[model samples]
Target: MEENNSFSIKNWNEDDRPREKLLLKGRTALSDTELIAILIGSGSRNESAVSLSQRILASVSNNLSELGRLSIPELMEFKGIGEAKAICIAAAMELGRRRRTGEALERKKITSSNSVFEYVQPIIGELPHEEFWILYLNNSNKIIKSAQLSKGGITGTVVDVRLAFKDALQLGAVGIILAHNHPSGTLKPSQADIQLTKKLKTAGDSLDIKVLDHLIITEKAYFSFADENML
Candidate 1:
């Protein structure tokens, strides 16, 4: 019952092995599969670690974002990948997600619509549903905090203007920017969107908090009310 066709990392040349190649040529020289192979350590007797890693990547169409969405149980469905390997992959992906969030949070000031888009895209743009967010800024226009005011389905979400202003007041923010994403990928603002912006601006005026802009974001592009002279 013994199978003859089997490949192992130990049987490969040192230059071809993932760990050795990484050490000799720098991490960038290793392909995605090689990098993942190093994380899981070894593959089944019938397959090399690189081959197994390739199959896993292939299952997700080689998309890292898609791969990041895979659950540990889903990864464990593959042969040679057990709880330990699955956990390792999940932990690595989570770290990457946190790193992206941290980078976005590190930006000091909001100078334009483009700056706001860059800051909020990683936080909500890629989401499959609608999310309304408010960026609270100090007198110098530096971001004090950003908070999600509401989350809804593909079509739309309800924003509580009261809660948004409450957070701004608590943070002592002198200015606020409103933003939300359309899951449909359309940048055109709805009549409701226009109405909401006007309402928020009026409320801000009463509180002495400036409503700087309202942005409608899709995955690839955005609409800025301020730039359009609608603010």
Candidate 2:
């Protein structure tokens, strides 16, 4: 007796091809490999898109989760993935990451350092330079708005006290939480940090806006000026 079956992309049936399945059934109906095949676009001269995707995944340890973890540079290490595909993969992952984080933020009120850190950490965690952000708050302590105020180099960061107050006035904010990332990842506030905080606090005092806290963030950690009694 002879038993036979065909499983090549050519034999996947008209409805099962990635393009056809995507158009007819929607992308969710496809497996991880199928989704990756669509991203990969084409295959080697002898291989199909599905086969190339499978090979790429296998090179990353046979798990899509592992493949997802690879940075753009790391993903480009695989054969047949040039700059375009590498950027596509990285962009896709970043979009997914932002979506998940945004969902979490939507469910919570900004009430504590942890909450502010959770929101602002992602916005500034990977910056090569320093970024100063101001989180404006309403009467009940809910967030009114958040804005990046300034950016600077390793030693000298500048924040215009008048400009910061102007934004607070524009937001009609009753209070604010100031934050900046330490590219060096140190939570300790420098003397300059204290000087700037005092200036902003003084400006807020005059304008009847409370300066709630100044948060210093790093990729691995954060610091709160209020928590350390610096405010």
Candidate 3:
């Protein structure tokens, strides 16, 4: 207990060391702290790597997503976590995020608001400011390409209608979905949001491109203009 907490990995029983345990039982057998300890490589004189990792997780409420949000500097503030360890943890988290994004992009179709939410959430939902994106889709509604059209302050972003349509044309897309994130996490669409949806829909109509939906996304939920009959 206390002995385990104070001792370094070298002093731990072979099976209890993170790397050894992982090799013996597979990655799934290692706890979050153990996996993080492995990334950290070592610990300070006052605590074992596992114990230090436990403290790091505690600082973020044991939420891995929250941990993933930490910058390298923020991670380095933890005892026993130097620049190398901090970068390792941050890089690992980023790789996981990219993997999820790649998986979302590989889906065959954009069939529902929920599907849109899953695809774009990793890209923009948790942003601290507003950003606008357009998903260009083929006639079958499969996403051909997605692009960020603008980024702005907390309240809103400017959407360039012509540029968005130009990208859609270049992609040979027959339809598009508009998306933006509200950093404040409120699902309610602002009056500006309503107006933008109407405007984009009208513009797409002129180009013979359907505006499939406009989604106002937050970290946890989303409001769909089409779902509410607002599009």
Candidate 4:
């Protein structure tokens, strides 16, 4: 999927170009493609970075949203995207996704299950399969760190609550949030989800660390067991 454009960035009037736009309007004003062009740094012999970015977006079904969801290996399918560029794109996309949550995450500390979803959704919501992850928090309820506890079938994935606690203890985490994705886009908490939360809660109780919430993320939304008083 290639569109031949006789006019490249060099042909465009410099004042209206993306680099100029960045300097003038600031980065927030640029679209995803425009930001991507800056990261690309250069295009092929015949094209400019902005042109390359346009072509890359076109190749990915003309969807910048889908491009935001691309895995590193999937991004490498582009002709000029080597390791560094691919990682740069991945990181930028991640940061952009996180920013979409608006200012709620910053105005106040996370207090409930929905708040936990706000943090985890950016990192794993777009995934097509399950990823069970844990957010370790300090006594203040601020997240200290996060780690993938397991990755497999959502309901049947092996989880060792003891091992999870061990990791949290090592980080001196005083609380934790359990998060996992539902590729089927259903937010309903499965029996397995409930069971896992119970295990984590019991373990946290023993360690004097609170289990903040257990979030079930779907493609478009999430469910919080704690919010529903289920946890």
- The best candidate in terms of TM-score: 3
- Model 3, residue 7: displacement in angstroms? 16
The better candidate by TM-score, 1 or 2, is 1
lDDT of each: 0.88, 0.80, 0.89, 0.78
Q: TM-score, each model? A: 0.81, 0.69, 0.91, 0.67
Off by over 4 Å in 1: 1-16, 77-80
Put down candidate 1 lDDT per residue, 64-164, tens digits, no spaces: 76677788999999999999999999898778777877887787699999989988877777678999999999989999988899999988999999999
**Winner of 2 and 3 under TM-score:** 3
| Sort order, lDDT high to low | 3, 1, 2, 4
Model 3 misplacement above 4 A: 1-16
* Superior by lDDT: candidate 2 or candidate 4: 2
What's the true lDDT of residue 148 in model 2?
85
**How far off is residue 101 in model 4, in Å?**
11
Q: After TM-score superposition, what is the CA distance of residue 68 in candidate 1 from its true location, in Å?
A: 2.0
**Model 3: colliding residue pairs:** none
What would the per-residue lDDT of candidate 2 be over residues 1-231, giving only the tens digit for each residue? 343566444666432489877887888898877788787787666777788677777787776545656778887787777788888877776786687569656844677888888888777765668999988888988787888888899664788888888988998999999999998878888898899999999889999999999999887589999888888
Q: Which stretches of candidate 4 lie over 4 Å from their true place?
A: 1-16, 41-52, 58-65, 71-73, 76-88, 94-108, 153-156, 167-174, 203-209
